[model samples]
Target: MTTAIIKPQWSPLTIALMVMGFIIFWPLGLAVLGYILWGEKFGGSPEKAQAYWNKGKAWCSSNAPRHHRNHWNRSSGMSSSGNAAFDDYRAEQLKRLDEERARLDAEIDAFHEYMANLNKAKDREEFDRFMNERRGSRQGYDQNKPDNGDNNNGWGSNNA
Candidate 1:
């Protein structure tokens, strides 16, 4: 029997290496820890290592988040779940949900448009009120000025 160089066991040398790896870079430390944990599966022939890799890949895919799994399923089209009635029900429900989402999106757009129009009207009203008040103040000031007939056009003459 051939003995492997680095046996997968907790030794002082391995621990020290792992610690050093961490001090150098974090991913290096993580890689060292993974080797310490699962290096036995990779020490054999290529076929054994490939089999272990495939197993780990399968485990990761199976444990992936629901949204990611659903995205894969959607890209591949609907797969049969072994029962026709259940499949039909699921398809119908998905279609209904999609239609409802579209309707809600349209409603949201309409609401944003209405709010924009309302804001514009409010701004116009405020601007009109400000203009009217400014005109009124200017007319009151013109009425209050005494009519000096020298025709200086509101500028006092040098004949003071």
Candidate 2:
């Protein structure tokens, strides 16, 4: 017959801490702090950790609060409105990114068409004319140059 040894009976730290805590603060301290810490080090699963934490929570809720109940309520669970807001912001950012991607795609398509048109250009004169047309007509300079003379009223005088 093969005996499959369970983990709890073999942990040395649990025994030591349990002894120390038992000697110092008796059952309450051993169960509360020492056992929990030991269990955290050597315990199997998240459920056990939660159990330890739940024990502490139950103690605190019952003993600490005078009247208020810590039962499941609308506002009892962990709030993630901040995260939800962040998610909304993230969605908006993704939407903006999609819009930008579409715009860039359109621009790329237009650029490819322009390049194709340039390649099909008849001659050097046609290419030069096309470049000049794409550059657009330059704005005519203002012929009326302003005379730099002190002709304004004395608005800078101290009128206080």
Candidate 3:
């Protein structure tokens, strides 16, 4: 007989992390929240989920020492290579470098955007000024020149 089991196996600390993610981005929060709450249930039947969960549970229980090391690595944001202090320092340095890279990327994008907008405005202003000067020159030339449209003798007539 194939029996189905609904086990009471879960953790609430994951929910806290989900909440923190929501504080960062709501969609990311929702995705992780939904996965933790209903991922296996929706993904498959109860028997399948039970089998999957049990398999993981068996594997973890079989590797208690590795599990502890992995847990430490995740919680401390550093790998367990037999040196705690060095691992902590390495994690800190990596985190700082990531933050610095993000900051520099944002600054570069902002600077490029600012320079593009400045050049566009300058070009527009210069074009408008040039058009204004051309219009003024045309109007002045028309106003100062002669308009003897009474004779049809072309420019061959010395009837000045």
Candidate number with greatest lDDT: 1
Clashing pairs in 1: none
Per-residue alpha-carbon lDDT of candidate 2 for residues 85-126, written as tens digits (9 for 90 to 100): 886886688689989999999999999999888777757778
Ranking by TM-score: 1, 3, 2
Give me the displacement of residue 50 in model 3, in angstroms. Answer: 61
Global Cα RMSD, each model? 10.6, 26.2, 16.2
Return whichever of 1 and 2 wins on lDDT: 1
Candidate 3's residue-wise lDDT over 1-160, tens digit each? 3232432224566677688879999999887787677665544467877877898899887878977867877767744658888888878888899999999999999999999999999999999999999999999998997877856546576665
| Of 2 and 3, the candidate ranking higher by TM-score | 3
Per-residue C-alpha lDDT of model 1 across residues 1-160, encoded as one tens digit per residue: 3387656667898888889999999899888898889887787578888998899999999899998898789657988777999999989999999999999999999999999999999999999999999999999999998986768786766685
lDDT value for model 3:
0.77
Better of 2 and 3 by lDDT: 3
Which has the better lDDT: candidate 1, or candidate 3? 1
